[model samples]
Target chain A: MTPEDMDLLAALGRTRAGLKVEADKHYVVESRLAPLARREGYPSIEALVAALRAKREERLIWAVVEALTVNDTAFFRDRATFAFLRETALPELSRRRKDGSVRIWSAACSTGQEIYSLAIAADEARNLEPGVRFEFFASDLSERCLEKAQSGLYTQFEVQRGLPIRLLIKHFENHDETWAISPRIRQAVRWRRINLMSDLSGMGAFDLVMLRNVLPGLDLSVRARLIENLAARLTEDGLLVLGEAESLAGVTEALHPVAGRPGVFARDPAYRAAAA
Target chain B: MKTCLVVDDSRVIRKVARRALEDIGFDIAEAADGMEALAWCRAAMPDAVLLDWNMPVMNGLEFLQRLRQEPGGDAPVVVFCTVENKVENIRLALDHGADEYIMKPFDGEIIAAKFAEAGLL
Candidate 1:
């Protein structure tokens, strides 16, 4: 890319809204965005950025954003986190809910891997408690990602990553080269296009909200805002999970880290007791 | 009895592999990590080594590299037992003097076949 393209990407990165595709990542950006640039009658990244700057069309801006969004997801990404969710969090939620219905939201759930894994956990939880009800809400900022998540089809390699064979056989069926999640597991989740930067009140309260592997790219203000926004939607006794590398330090005063579980925090119940 | 060194970080995987290898008449010597495996190899030369790719310290690839640098490097047939089944990983292991590669959650029959291929059977 030319100096102009580099400058454009750097500017986007400063906004902390873009992933900041660096000089080394130019090839990746070029490959992902080239087709869209070609279809728009732009011959190069320079022309594409010019059009994007002129506010020529919302579609072109969206195309740029979509191209920049890193959607590197696989089935059961981070097995230990899922294991904790299965062995500890879900059971705790089940016990706390008098109605026996547990709701979970996977914010920034790119390509639905995390949500689908939650579906597997929910299925297992339901088997343990026959009367337990579960609902999973999976949301992503990018419409393109939401589309992939809704489709719920993955390559054999994708499905095999971190997915045990027993869960694979139980929740997926082979469809030629791809493995599609079973309808029952698919039905358990509700997918929506949601911007983490926007208000989350309409999504309703949730027992658990997974914001894993996303905070590092965000600016401190945006990260704090996102946490506060999510905290409002968290059930009084809900759990908030960040990326393993992400921390709540200076992000929110309402959350206290849960010992032994990285990136996991519980709402301050004393505040609730005082309010009550 | 044929002796096999099982090198893995997970206790569950070690147990499973031990049962399979022992049932096929191989005596099992287990190591929790790659460094321990190397030490065990130096002390007692096993007929075969079942090596895991990822470990806390001294990963399998590094261990294999070091092992190949040692005297009688090619004496014991080394089978890479790992969760990472990428072709590149397999190629790297073979290039670094591994005899074979097996994906995780493997069956006893596959282990037997690998042992037979290594002339351990």
Candidate 2:
């Protein structure tokens, strides 16, 4: 790919998806977009970029943006996070809520694994507090990924990653070569096609918002804005879960890290009082 | 050096499983069928057993039953690695003392993940 092609694709990614394609990561862009260009019937990457620059076609443009976005995820990705949710987060939320209803949002839920994992956590939480009920809301930028997530069908290889054997047997129906998650688990969540760069006020507040592994790929300004939007959508006592390696050090102080938890954050009381 | 006895009538499957199990730091042993697996267990109990559902002479379920009756047979973690995908088959294996069930066409990653879940890794 030419330098000009790289710049155009980078600009397209940033403007459309809030993704920041680093100058050094040109290979990542090329590797991901090469197949896309071929499938789109373009002779070369340069031809595809030229076509993109010529006119703004919504379908093709969004296709390029979605391809650039990283969608790597697995079931119960970090076991410790779910353990903390089961042992501490769910119990505490159950204690505080008098109506016995807790709402969760899986922001940037790629291929539905994370959301289903959250569903499993909620399903098992009945053992802790029988009165507590969880409502799930999940969203993604990619329509294709969302479709796969909606299907709840996973290949043998996909099911092997980070999924415990017991949960696999319990929650999924085994087919010849694929596993489909039970309808009870799939229907528990409300799915939407959302762009975090835009306004989020229409969506209701959540008790727990999981924006894991998303911020790292976004530009700096977009990350802060996304965090602010996420913070606004969280209830006063709601929690926000980020990726393990992610931090809010230079990001907005709308939320503060919950003590003793690496990735989990709580709505900052100070920020809330000031906003009030 | 935890030992795992891979029991399958098919030598190809046994070899594939041996390579995968060895890659994850397990001492490997191969058995032709359930009877040989039972004999191997009678002499020395392995840390785990990767058993196939169907085989000549003695099948996986039969071997599991007989192994459980042996003096120290209940020690090994028996994981049924077979083409059996039916829920009834899975329930049967679990009911007959199998610890976990993995469908066929598995790889090293699956073995590692399952072993880790079973606390053998």
What is candidate 1's fraction of native contacts? 0.00
* Whole-model lDDT, model 1: 0.77
Q: Residue B66 deviation, candidate 1, in Å?
A: 33
Per-residue CA lDDT of model 2 for A152-180, tens digit only, reads 99987788777876688899997777899
Q: Point out where model 2 deviates above 4 Å.
A: A268-276
Docking class of 2: acceptable
| lDDT per model vs. reference | 0.77, 0.86
- Show where candidate 1 strays beyond 4 Å: A2-4, A7-32, A38-41, A126-128, A269-276, B1-121
Top TM-score prediction, candidate number: 2
For each candidate, the DockQ is 0.05, 0.46
